[model samples]
Target: SYKPNIAFYEAHGLKGWQALEKTIAYLNEKCPDHFTIADAKRGDIGNTSSRYAKAFFEELNFDSITVAPYMGKDSIEPFLEYENKHTILLALTSNVGAFDYQTKMIGDQMLYQKVIDISKEWKNSRNLMYVIGATKAEYLADVRKIIPDSFLLVPGVGAQGGSLEKVCEFGMNDQVGLLVNSSRGILYASNGRDFAEAAAKKARELHVQMKKILINY
Candidate 1:
């Protein structure tokens, strides 16, 4: 599966959008079996939310999209409405700032816990997945207790110094529930023309490592 951060292309305006469209087109044509994720943390009011959902889920033909949960169900249900698609909510992010809000206790539970617990009751909640930062491997146990069956899209595994071993240990479910994204660690493996080769090598190393862990587990 491929996850592209829209900001890198959106920063270029129309030309960027065209490029992104072309990229998605090529991926869909050549790699139909692979899942495609538009890593746009989009959420807004009703009409605006519907537009964003249409833009990614319909126009761009992405299989899933990441979204912010701050706006609650109204901003999210529009995305969830699409069948055979996924809406990935921000639960516990993989960043330093996560401790600032996500971990802070709102009552007996942390704020992130409340976000996850509440989201399960929303319309079409079965379409929901979550973004849990791999850096927060320690918190995976608590998160799994809430959504044990839902998939988790985990970032920060490579360049951000997150341990794959630790993440799998606490985050793995019966479904092998994880979609780990590593951007710079693979994409920037080299600056030369051999970059694709280098990137593939890095990805393969991680793949082999993951397979070993799963086999042992």
Candidate 2:
């Protein structure tokens, strides 16, 4: 299985990030079969992004990292350089604030559609993926026009109220290129020490749902 990108942990904080690392290690040890992601949403100028890439892909040993693309192609190129690793770029976000920019029409197409088109030019971008908010199911068909093959990390399922059936309906691909994330809905399922068990249970529910979704493809 693939990993859930950065927003999942950042919403927590420093302590939560630490918990994320420990969780990654535990999962890597116990469920080595599944891929791990550092949803860091990090991207800076020059060598800054390089170090961010190293911390997540090297030091933390995450299989992938989420990066912002607004700074320019160079800011994202370094993260894309990581071998066999994924770089999930923020395309269309799930929040209401997304209307502040993502939905703005630019001569017939949304701004995010242009970003997706331009990203195809970056180095080693074949490993590049996009962050598509699950709430915007209607936009998935349009997004598919730009990046039909690349994977998409979709958030806003349970707690955010994005429907699973709707996201899969528009986002599923031949390679099953959709990673639907549910963090608070999964992690904080309980306040007890059995939180990890609860998280696993939540993950299992999503996995079961994913299995059914995949069968349709």
How many clashes (backbone N, Cα, C below 3 Å) per candidate?
Answer: 0, 3
Off by over 4 Å in 1: none
lDDT of 2: 0.84
How do the residues 1-217 of candidate 2 rate in per-residue lDDT, one tens digit apiece? 5454456667789977887778788877898878777767888995899999888888888888888878989899988888888888999998999889887888878888978888999999898989999888889999988888889999889778898999988988887788888877786788999999988898899889878877776
Pairs of residues at least 3 apart in sequence or in different chains that clash in candidate 1? none
How high is the lDDT of residue 72 in model 1? Answer: 91
lDDT of 1 by residue, 34-140 (tens): 99999999999878999999999999999999999998989999999999999999999999999898898998999999999999999999999999999989999
Cα displacement (Å) at residue 126, model 1: 0.5
User: What's the residue-level lDDT of 79 in candidate 2?
Assistant: 88
- Clash pairs, candidate 2, are 5-39, 6-39, 6-40
**Top TM-score prediction, candidate number:** 1
Candidate models: Cα lDDT each: 0.95, 0.84
In model 2, where do residues sit more than 4 Å from their true spots? 1-21, 192-198
